[model samples]
Target chain A: MSLEVKTNVAPSKTKVMTMKRLKRREKIEGWLFVLPFVISAAVFFIGPLLVAFMLSFKEYSYLDMVSMFEAPWVGLSNYINAFQDSTFLRALLNTSLYSLGVVPIQLFIALVLALIVDLNIKGKTFFRVAYYIPTVTSTVAVSVMFLFIFKTDGILNKILSFFNLPPYNWFGDTRLALPTIMMMAIWSSVGLYMVIFLAGLQDIPMSLYEAARIDGASKIQEVLYITVPLLKPTIFFNLVVSLIGTFQVFDQAFVVSNGTGGPLDSTMTVVLYLYKTGFRDFQMGYASAIAFILFAIIFILTLIQRKFFGEETEF
Target chain B: MKKLIALFTAAVMAVGLFAGSTFKPAKVNAATKKVIRLGVWASSPAESELLDNQIKEFERLYPNIKIQKLVITGDYNQVMQVKIASRTEPDVFYLDVYQAPAYIAKKVIAPLDSYLDKNDVKDFEPSLLKGFTSGGKIYGLPKDYNTLVLFYNKDMFKEAGITKAPTTWKELEEAAKKLTKNGVKGLSLSIDAARFIPFMFQSGAKINDGDKPVFNTPQAAKGLDFYVSLLKKGYAATPKELGVGWNGDALAQKKVAMVIEGGWMIPFMKDAAPNVNYGIARLPKGDKEGDLVFTVAYAMSARTKNKVEAAEVIKFLTGRQALSMTAESGLAIPSRISMGGVYTAKYPERKPLVDMVKYSQVYQFGIKSSKILDALNKACEKLYYKKVKDAKTALDQAIKEVK
Candidate 1:
């Protein structure tokens, strides 16, 4: 009986070795498959990042951009200057306000849209497609259309006049300019977040809802206790993404203002200010410093969000 | 298989590198013809076609030199800046007088003194030539220029019971008030430095006093006050306030009875509002005849490989023959005094625009003009929107910002 056991174990040892060799081969194949993407990312993404980091410490002008290494190193002067600049400060405040104003409203609208479309109703696909159309449209085309709509005698003002409300210069008025852009932002972005929320809604188990119904839960109660808690992860993701996107807003403001950031610079976002400084003013180093500061702000906000929302969701 | 794929990728990249390097003109033999790239911004399709025709004529005259006309569509300065930075700037390009100072200071533009001796620079308007000169050296040759002129809608003037256009500031104010009726403003004012500069000049207020912005002086303040009061009294309205894009747009749509525009507006008015029945006249004068002359010059890049060829192209473009042909397109008044007669004759309505050039001040605010203009524009906007108490305060703020 002992000899028979030894023979059986010996054969099993060879089997284990073969299994280990197969696993090693699979690992090598997986890396080979991902090699192209890694190489491209290293060339494009990592390359620019390294160059920009090096440039941030130097006084890189348009002339210096061609021969990057020839630019004189100014240490942290660019960063210091950015903090001292009144326009940069204003841009920061404006971008923060825009992000704070747009993110919550846009997400709420998106969630409401997602919930309505997720209901047991006909023509659901039609509603989803219609809602998603703005998301797929070109930003420039949409911004140009919105420019006409927000004009003093535009469709929006005509509607306001019907209700006996006075018309305002949406782009020209300092008080209304940023808010008008925010409204457009909320309108154009709701569709994308709604689609994201819909995907999250479908992932939720039906058994949990059925159980809630058996307990005689009201519609509002079910949504409050079950839906809200279960959708926290999705909400967190959308919140972080929208925050970053809204903070870097440029295209809409640039197009509507004709690249001036005018009407008293009320709609000047940080990115727009950076673009003007870098490309228009040829202050690439200062612009890079502004970019890094913006990145820091977004990074800190994301960290705080993660801390409060908690990363893992057991449900 | 993996090695093969890697090798194929390397081969593709190698070929791309070779193709890019080959894009630049290779060192040619002495017998081979040379190519000279000319950069210009075309305001309209007609202007572009006219330029193309001129280029063809130029190439025909000089068989050994090929003229490659690069028609820059938008943001001409920014595109040219990038090209300059990359050391791929065109051999000859259009340079606005207002921007020439900055480019000259940076040594990006070559001094055309040597080239001008043969080209007869004295034939061009002295002030226009003076605009592109720095440190006793000419940097560019003026191609064409325009001054602000009053463009009044005849039908609107008739409706207002006014026969003649306003010839003075006081008359303009009274006429504007009378014309301000039935949702139609008498004048469409644009709150910009380009529009405001003439008023300052009219009051004998120089933009700069030895390299410092002194527009906040009492003379300039007086001019600015009168200008802003027209808006306050509802006699004039800004284009934005009228829900239009510009003064020209307001006039074209009949939103305003009068607008101050440049020679470039003739074609735009013809195309946009054919039946508006408008007449061009000299801009309403102040203490003295005051108008702003905007000029663009043909400047050669300092680092150009073919300097002689580029200078030849510039000379030809700004010469009598080419200027007369281009003037017929009605885009600009010829910079050369001799060709002015030809331009005025070709387009009879543009005579007022040409007449203003004699007394008009060239639009040059020094090397830091863009910043100064931006500050002034903001200040003007503040005054226009009533965010500031008065013109003095607004001008003061602008002066402080510029300094």
Candidate 2:
């Protein structure tokens, strides 16, 4: 009788009734709950973002700090110049190559690590922490350590020399500086994603594996068909986040290159170039243009990734 | 309901009043007096102590004003740029003459012509003073200066069978070639292409030509070719491939028989490599009979909060007595013309300082210093590292890029 009574009501009517009750308290409590966050977001994030956006449209040089308000506005000119700038184009290419190179390799390595850890590998926490050490360590400290290790007379080449390997200038050589930085980025980023993959692996139901086994599916077949398909959403989330992070990689390159992005500007990434333009050259407007352009690229790439790989979950 | 609305209206007005009050700018309370922040390059602990002493003296004279010393550990030009961006630039900061033209062009540095004329500033070297002038306005007063001097190991000179220090370009080349041997080089220079401007000057080539880099001149080509030939004959280190810090560090380590450095090395060598028997002489003169001298000055930021008071502090710090004291301490050769006497009397061993100033050249900053600097660096790098077969071609490319 209760079930029949519940079924008599229209679904839309029930939703409307529930929404009406929600609206009565929402004005007070909803705001009460979200007020702090709204204030913080407005003060910290939105304020700076708006300022940066405005700054992008103006010519603000560091030389004339007092003349900040007097800086003439040249609408869209800075953006146009940024697109035409050779350094920006190179930085875009470098950042693109870095993103393409790091995301796939890091994801694959993370997946393998997740699989290994999922096997209930002995000392799982120990191995996880060991991998995560790089992520936790300060980037400046890590960059300095790597600098010494990769120097001409450093340990890596010293070891190579013992094996009759000819030593090449790793940090000083233009061709290798970017690759070396990329390797470090991959090394530092893989562990965090490994944890995410491990969580995703746990979320896959035991029933699916049992059912597959009953159908005489092999381990490889189970991984290929069940595990990968189930983990698609999580993998896509990581891919998009990493893509953003890699594009904005300033600290590693900054520290490694000693802020010049030199050894022939081969390792000059987009953020570093933005920094040079904004601060070094005092071309704040142009730098703002570059920043917005980067934002657009990241936004577009994320949308494309979502369209292609973002799968809906049934549960 | 009307009473409740009145109460709410009052509350809203109260909040509005508070916000509006903040917008009208606050009064300067006694407790809110601004500290005078002075930014300078990072120094060693010992140097910091000496500066601290100077600061104490400065405070003693002006008890009401508090001075804050900010030390930076990066390129001073970039540091200045960063500080300017933040709108918290120091009242007084260090300025290098090589890159001061840009700051001068922007009027970021205050002109001190009126101050000098009013104060009747005396005992300042005219040539050194002229270096800081732009647009017929004097920007800043130099505190001290350094001219390049050829420093050689007395023992190395004896071993190489060369009795006297090389004076002319041809003799300098022969001495260097004769001095080259197994595990010991003829000379070590801070030959990193980035620092190659001084080298061009040493070779009788000026980097500036009416605010442009015109290295296409025959003399510039000859200068570049000569540098390349020296490198080819194994007389110079590979650009940026040395283990030690520029010329001084290599000299200190006894890795090179001779090097061209500055007066600051006298104190540095006394501390770092005390046992290395070294003597200083005038820099080997270029074919045009000139040498390069580098100088630094204390510049006042244009946006200083207390301009009048800050200028007073700068004046005291860079005055005749202060300059003489600085030279007496042997930190560097004082910028004052009068202190040249004090420098000579105090440091008798440094014959180089006396000779260098007599024939020392100066680095000139043109409108396009950035492009010229980069082009010059690349050209020198190519020549010094033997990357280009033709020095003239590399120089021509540099000239093209500089323009």
Candidate 3:
């Protein structure tokens, strides 16, 4: 009876094991598909982040290559210096003001334009493409164009001359430099947010609007009730992205000021200051500290935003 | 009696305050066959061309070596510091005579005492040589040098009823005022920081006290005020107002009657505005009566894989052939005395450059020169743009910011 049981090791059992093997093969193929992206994230993103965090505690310079590891560790000294650095403080303040100045104004302008474009109008595609051109153009190209238009003898002044209005030294004047940068930032970025808003506007349910209109709800009231609530997710995305982008703004300031953060360093941003500290001053450790500080600021702000606007808070 | 005692005590204190300490040279390897990479500022096309050739020659002469020339375009010093910190430093790089001390103290660039002892550098200009000498050791040798030349548009001068260039500040002011008209500015001085070095030097204003800022002097205030006055009276344009990179272009287009630019501009002006009649002359003297001369030199890099070869390359680049080649390239005035004559003999139109170099006084900002100048420039920008009116207060603010 025992011999008969051994011989009768079922064909069904073998078939079941083959079926399990097929499922495992499919799972392996899925992992293989994601392998490239995972490897890249590990090497480029995670590795540098870990190193930068470690570097924040050291005193380092390119001249002393090995000094990154060999140099005496001075915990919190770089952070202390960054706090004490009036320039760094000023950069932080300017960056904050710029973020405050740009994000809301740009978002509002973008939303208005998006709403207009969303209306039943002829050549809507043409208008959309025209509005989106600046968004796709290179930052350097846009910056150079703005530079000429705002020059003392450039077109802006020429146009201003028609009305007998005095011209402004956009970049040279310390008081105006930051504001001028903000204006340029708005011009370059508004189009991007506009497209997003357009998409969000389209996603709102037509049924709700129909119901509101039938119930004698005013346009403003309908928009407030239906459009905004439905577009909450989109608004949250733009807000977080804008916050991150504005906090780390470097290119425009660098190009406009010719890398000096000049006209009295009034146009200096945190990223610019970080660059100066890292690359200009050769205080890599200090620069690393600044980088981490910037990261922390962005991370904390993002967290705050998530808490305020996350999925948990349905409104 | 108490007042006299107080005065005496104050006098002693003042003297004590001025008792600035001297620098003691650090110990460095002299005998080892080490490699040092040198970085240099590539201001014009000529320097880059000559540097490449010099490196090749050095390699051929000393085959047991590798010499790397890191060419820096704008903000070379700032870039060099980063490279140095990364231990990817050039052994020798362009050190502005006024800004060399900080790097010297940082010990990023080693002293050339042993090298200087081994080589005879007597043929080089004594004044130029002395500018790079600190603690009785030469750090680098000047490769290309410049002094401010009054590049005047002869057509504008003619239209304004002026035939000759201004030799003094009084004459210059008068010429500028006469040249002023609708749609045309008299001068193209940028109130930005680049002008501060020349302006301060021209007016004989000192910028540093050891490592500290000391631009609170009456002379410093006077210089800054003079700069502001030029903008206020419509003699010059703010960097932003005129647009950045407008100085040469303005002069070239005859938009501005005159501009104070370096010797290198001789070639640029000739090419850009060939139709516009122009001539070069000495910079209008300041109240203190000296012209600001700017010189950049080639030094061996500290991180170069071949120090002997790199030094050889630096020497070759600053030598007669390279100097003449640089001069012939018509980019800048060469450091070697003979190169100037050779260039002039070959190109008579460049005779004005020779005259400009003769009256050129060295720009000595001690160390922290770039930062100090940047601070002053920022202050000037504020004043010229009418952001601030009180020159003394602005200058004081600048001094404070720098400190």
Q: Considering only chain B, report the TM-score of model 2.
A: 0.84
DockQ of each: 0.29, 0.27, 0.22
Give a tens-digit lDDT track for model 2, residues B31-98.
45445778889876766766676777877877766677888886777778867767768888888776
Residues forming the 10-long window of minimal summed lDDT in candidate 2 chain B: B25-34
Please tell me what DockQ candidate 3 reaches. Answer: 0.22
Rate residue A239 of model 1 by lDDT. 92
Candidate 2 chain A, poorest ten consecutive residues by summed lDDT: A1-10
lDDT by residue for model 3 over A1-315, one digit each (tens)? 243346556878766666787789889987776655555566768987897888899987655535566776989999998899888999999999999999989888888888888999998888888888988998889889998888877888889988999887777767888998899999899889999999988877788899889999999998788887778778888898988899999988998888878777888999998887676555778999999999899999989988877773232
Summing lDDT over every window of 10 consecutive residues in candidate 1 chain B, give the lowest-scoring window: B22-31
In terms of docking quality, model 3 is incorrect
Q: Which of 2 and 3 is ahead in DockQ?
A: 2
Cα lDDT listed for each candidate: 0.85, 0.75, 0.74
| Chain B TM, every candidate | 0.92, 0.84, 0.79
Positional deviation of B110 in candidate 3, in angstroms?
3.9
Q: Please give, for residues B1-403, the per-residue lDDT of candidate 3 as tens digits.
A: 5445445556756776665321111113224334445566664565566667767776676665555555677677667765666666666677777656656655666556565543447756555776677777877888877766778888888878997888776788899888889877788887655555555556776666555777777777777777678778987764455554758888776678888777667667668877877787776777654556677776655545555666666677687777777777766677777677877787776576566655455665565665576677777767765777677787888787666
Taking the true A–B contacts (Cα pairs closer than 8 Å), what share appears in each candidate? Answer: 0.27, 0.29, 0.56
Candidate 2 vs. true structure, TM-score: 0.82
Model 3 CA deviation exceeding 4 Å by range: A1-35, A205-207, A210-221, A312-315, B1-103, B116-119, B209-212, B347-367, B385-390
